[model samples]
Target: MTQKLAGRTAVVVGGGQTPGATVGNGRAAALTYAREGADVLVVDRDLDSAEETAELIRKEGGTSLAHRADITVEADCESIAGAALDTYGRIDILHNNVGIVPAGRTEDLAAETWRRGFEINLTGMWLTCKAVLPHMRHRGSGTIVNISSMAGLLAGGETIAYNTSKAAVHSLTRSLAIEYAPHGVRVNCIAPGMMDTPMGVDANARAGGVSRDDVAAQRAAMVPMRRQGSGWDVARAALFLASDESAFITGVVLAVDGGFSLRAGIQ
Candidate 1:
C-alpha cells in the first residue's frame, strides 16, 4: 500500500509512450517506482516523451527527471548513467526496458534490421549494464531488471531477429546474476507475454497482419485468464525486484504472462 523502495534511485530506460492511449512498459515502470518512493530517472530516445513521463511522476508528488539517449550507443548509455549519478548521487535500480521488434523471418529480414533489433533489444541492455555496473559494484549493492519477452522463452513466429535478441537478454541476465551475486548486486529478467501496450499493439499490427483489436482478441484467447495483461502487471513485478522484497531473488526470469506460458493448449 506504500513505499517499498524508499530512498532508492531508479533509472528506467525506454520510458516513453508512443502516439496513442497506451503507455509503454518503461513509462509505467518509472511511475510505479516513483510511487513507491524512489527518485526516478525516465530515459528514452525521444526527449518529449521521456519528459512527459517525468512530468506525470512530478504531478503525482514524486521526484523524477528525464534523459533522452539512444540506448544502442555506448556513449549515450554512459552519458545517461553519468547524468543520473550526478542528479541522484547514487543508483539503486537499473531497469532495461528498451526493445524493438522488427517484423521479419531470418532470411527475409535485412541485415540492417536484424542488427538494429540486436542493437537495441540485446546490446542496449548490455551497454546500460556496462555503464551502471561499475557504480553499483563500487557501492556494493544494486538491482538490475532487464525486460525480456515471452518470445525469448518460446518461439516467436516470423520475428526471428526480435526473438533472438530477447533470448540473448535472458542469457545476459543469468551471467550478470552469477557474476554479481557475491557483490550484492541482483540481476533478473522479466519475460512478459502478450501485453496491452502500444509497443505490443504495434508488434501485433506489423507481425500478425490484422487490426489491433483482432490481434488483442487472438492473444487473449491464448491465455488461460481469458484476457491480455496490462503494463502495470509487468511494472508491479519490476517493483518487487527493484525493492528489497525480492532480496533473495536473482538470476530468475519471471514470466508475467497471464498463465499463457503454463498451458499446453486451449484444447
Candidate 2:
C-alpha cells in the first residue's frame, strides 16, 4: 500500500550512518517518503552520510537533497529550515530524529554530557520547530513528527540523560500539537522500543560493555517479539504521521515497540 505523501516535501534530521546499520532512521524515513512521492531533504551532521542516502533515493528515481547541519546548533537548525524553504518553496513535514544515547547513570554522567544530550535531543527539536513555524504558519498547514524512544516513557536505568531528553521531546510534541492544531498544523511523536538500527546496536554495545552481537542478543531477549525492530519499522510510523491518513491524529505518542513496552518483569 503506497502512502500518498506525493507532492509534499519532507525534512528528516539525523539521517546518517551509525555503527552497524548501513542507513539510520533518517535515511530510511527519507527513502520511504521519496518512494511515496515526496521530495526529501536529508539532513545530518555528516554530509557524506547524508549524501549517500540522497544518492540511494536518486538511484531509486526519487527526489532527495542532502543537507549537512549540526542540529545541536541553533544557527544550523535555522539555516537548514531556511535552505529547505528556499529549495522546496515550502515545508510540509519535519521529522526530528536527532538523539544520542550515551551510556551512564546520573552520577556517572558529567554535567557537560547531560547538557549535550539535551542540546541534541530536546533543544534541537525545539530550535528546528521554531525555525520552521513561521513558514508553516504562513502556509497554514504542516506536520511534525518527533522521534522519541520507549526510554522516554519508562525509566532507562543507565542512560538517564538520554531518557530525560526524550521525555522532553514527548512533552514538546504535545505542546506544539495543541498550540498549532488551530493553525492546521499537527505534531506527534513516535516512541520506539529496541530497534536493530546502527544507533541501537551501538547503544546496546555500550550498555552491555561487550561485543555487538552480545548486546544484540540481550536486546532481543528483552523484547517479546524475540527480535529487535528495524529502521523501516520506525520509518513506516513516521510516514503515517506525515501523511494525511493521520489528518486527525495529533499529540499522540505512538509506541512502535513490539510488545516490549507491555511485558511485565519476567518471573
Candidate 3:
C-alpha cells in the first residue's frame, strides 16, 4: 500500500454498490481510498450495501465503517457528518459520490420526476458539503471532491433535470473552492462520461429493455476513445483530487471522460 492518505479519514458518500456487470464509482473510490491508507466511512442509503463495502475494507486490513444516510435530507446529512467525526475523530477527505441519472424530456417527464432529479443530484451534494465543511474548516485543511457528469458540460437534445442539476454542481464546486480556500479547504469536481458502471450500462440496459451488450457497444462507439471508461478510471481521478498530490489544485473541473467531452468540445 502506497499510503498516500495515511493517518487521514475519508467520508465517501454513496459508497455501497452491488454492481451487476461493473463497479460503481462510489464503491471503487471507497476501496481506493482505503487501499491508499485512509480510514473510510462508507455512507449509503442502502444499509446492506454500505455494510458490504465496509466489511470488504476490514477484510483487506483497512479501517472502515458504514452508515445509512439519505443525503437529500438535511438531518441525515448532519447525522452522516457526526458519524464520521465520532468514528474517526477527524475528517480529511469528503467524496460526494451520490447522484441519480434519470433521463427524460422536460415536457414529457413528470414534474415530480424532474424535481426529484435535482433533489438527488444537486441538492444532496450541497447538503452533504454543508454538513462536512464546518469540520473541515475546524481542521484547517481538507479536500472535497464533487462528482458531476459530462452530460452536465454537454447535454443532448433532452436531459430533463439531470444534466441541468449536474451543471449546477460544477458551479457549486467552484464557488465553494474559492470561498473555502481562505479556510485551507480545497474543493474540486470530476465530470465523468459514459462509464461502464452499473449505473451507466446495466441500468440503461434495463431501462431501454435492450440487451446489456447492445447498450455497451452503442455507448463505446459514442466515446472518442473507442472504449468505455470504468469505475476505476473515475476513482483514480478522484484519488488525485483527494490526495495531497493536488495540494495546489482547487476550483477545477477535471474530466474523467475518454475524450468524449473533447469530442463534444466546449459546446
Model 3 Cα shift for residue 87 (angstroms)? 0.7
lDDT of each: 0.90, 0.87, 0.92
TM-score of 1: 0.95
Best by lDDT: 3
Model 1 agreement with the true structure over 201-243: per-residue lDDT tens digits: 7565765678888877888898889998989999999999988
Give the runs in model 3 whose Cα sits over 4 Å from its true position: none
- Reference-based TM-score, model 3: 0.97
Sort all candidates by TM-score, best to worst: 3, 1, 2
* lDDT, model 1, position 83: 91
Choose the strongest candidate by TM-score.
3
Model 3's alpha-carbon lDDT is 0.92
Please write out the lDDT profile of model 2 over residues 71-172, one tens digit for every residue: 778899999888898888889999988888766887788899888888888988899999988889889999999999998877776888888888899899
**Greater-lDDT candidate between 1 and 3:** 3
Each model's total of backbone clashes = 0, 0, 0
